[model samples]
Target: MPGITSPPLPAPDLIDIHCHQLSGSDHRQILSRDVHELASHPIAALDRIEALLTNRRYLSLGMHPWFIKHQTIETAFLRLKSCTHHPKILAIGECGLDKCIDTPMSVQIEVFSRQVQLSEELGKPLIIHCVRAFAELLQLKKSLAPTQPWIMHGFTGKPALAAQLIQHDCYISFGKALLQTGSQATLALQAIPLEQLFLETDAAGVSIDTIYAAAAKIRGIDPINLRRQIHSNFINVFFND
Candidate 1:
């Protein structure tokens, strides 16, 4: 085993805009429990994410919808409020609606609305989560002021859905679904404008670079250039300093 290694390929440049790297401990505990598929999982990545950001790589952080069950909703809100000021914390979620999970729709709405209020108050974007709940999320967006930016991460439904979100001024972040062969999200990917789009890994069993590679192929551009565009998109979507 002493020499059993192959040459390492260059790491593809990527910007995972909806990862869970900035949560307070209350949220970290759930990440520690849920993100087991990550080679190092959440705890180690917690330290790694801070370093990656300190080294000037990009990512966003929040309590994803799946973890909402582990703790009191009030405590999660408090944690989100407290962490939004960190220089690396560019957005207010990984929070929104998920129909695939059994977390109550009512609680999800409360948390989503609270986070939206926090985004407005803190002057950051909302990195949202939606499965089959896009209509409800859009309804909530209608009540917020027109100026607040909301970036929807892991978006992979359809071109019409993208059009609807784009019409409302919400940005969409694409992930693994677009990478899968012959998938509808891949078809949808062809329709989205680069300006209203972002990139993410979203706790999926894929690397940010792979997501970037798959996406750049769909965009017919080099991955490095795509990375820069996503970085620019991240800045524009979050509008955080």
Candidate 2:
């Protein structure tokens, strides 16, 4: 043991609220990191749950509006409901309105509503994936008056939209888009409070570490402080323990 010493332990990092690398090619790499991530995928793919659990990471399940044609509403609802009680599945979604998609709005609404209801009934937060349908999403939120938290993932909307979401007590997550110079996401990130903010990589190639650093710069705060706040937010909204 002469002239030898063990390496110090690593510290924990920010929580990636939404990502798709759970069971994908990069799953092992993500697991080896110090950060935590909420793995998102279709409810139909419950078989992938095991991989997410292996690292004790977070999970968000939903029937994305873009892939509605793949299954009947009944089947999707059933699959989602089956996983609602899983201990590691902290949230329900990646589900929300998407105006640009070819799927009929009515059908999308129906599936989205059921998922929202499931989130409400199970007392879990939602990881939304809204796209050009903020109005409809807000309307649904108004109609439901849910108490559980709802986080909009991959938000690159205007600052006003970010303000509106915060006013409604909905959190907004900034992803790789925030790193783009002069982007709307950058503006919104500046306007959003540290409490209502989250950083994610989504399915993008960017790392959470980079996203957190960029977010910290946009808000003009220390990266460590930003990481601490988001980690607190994650526990406050998801763990509640």
Candidate 3:
């Protein structure tokens, strides 16, 4: 860890629109691959991450698909449902479809559909975790189309896909992959209207502050200015005010 620079000062009022902090699939995904490098204690990880959030405060919670097999839907929902009332648990998810997994698409759909309904009822924005099932996912959304907002976390499709999702009135979260030079994902992000765009580090182990800096570069704006715009993007998507 020596020689590693500390996280930059957080954006002045910037929101980390998507992140995973619960003891579920995404957590185990990170820990199992590199358990020694990942944060061991949830409380300390939150505090360490919050230390970078000088001008913002909020985090999302969820049990991702890879862990869904670890618990019954009822048990998983019961645990996740209870966390909604906690202060700082600003959103619910990083949850949704994953067609590539052995888990039946039916089970994924069931859990995802239930979460969407509950999100609507609880009035919390939902951060999604979609893979190759965009069409099916969109159909599901159109059915309920919750009054609450839904953000597609870690979006990496072509501009056409981005256009399709944005047209549905769902927000998108761009990440480090989009910051790569001359990549399709990078171009796709460049094509996203500033208003419809948000940023994330996903499971990449990169800091959002770094991701934001790279995003500013991609958008040809100062970090401070991008901070303001992304703040607006966050509010437009999640803020009821």
- List lDDT for all candidates, in order: 0.67, 0.76, 0.68
Hey, what RMSD does candidate 1 come out at? 9.5
Q: Which stretches of candidate 2 lie over 4 Å from their true place?
A: 1-12, 23-48
Q: Which portions of model 1 miss their true places by more than 4 Å?
A: 1-13, 20-53, 57-61, 222-224, 239-241
Which order, best to worst by TM-score?
2, 3, 1
lDDT (10s digit) by residue, model 2, range 18-114: 8877533322121111001212344334555445555546666677776777666676566567666877777887788899989988888888888
Residue-pair clashes, model 2: 0
Supply candidate 2's per-residue lDDT for 97: 88
Put down candidate 1 lDDT per residue, 59-167, tens digits, no spaces.
Answer: 4455567887876666655555555566566666667899999998888888778778877787777777799999988888887654568888778788899889988
- Tens digits of per-residue lDDT, candidate 3, 1-241, equal 6798898765555455665432222111111111111133445455554454322445666656666776666765665665455445556676788987889989888888887877777777888889999999999988876787788888878889888887898888787786678766777777777887788766677767778887888878888888878777666655554
All candidates: TM-score: 0.75, 0.85, 0.78
What C-alpha lDDT, on a 0 to 100 scale, does residue 1 get in candidate 2?
56
Clash number by candidate, in order: 0, 0, 0
Candidate 2: 10-residue stretch with minimal lDDT: 28-37
Off by over 4 Å in 3: 1-11, 20-55
**Best prediction by lDDT:** 2
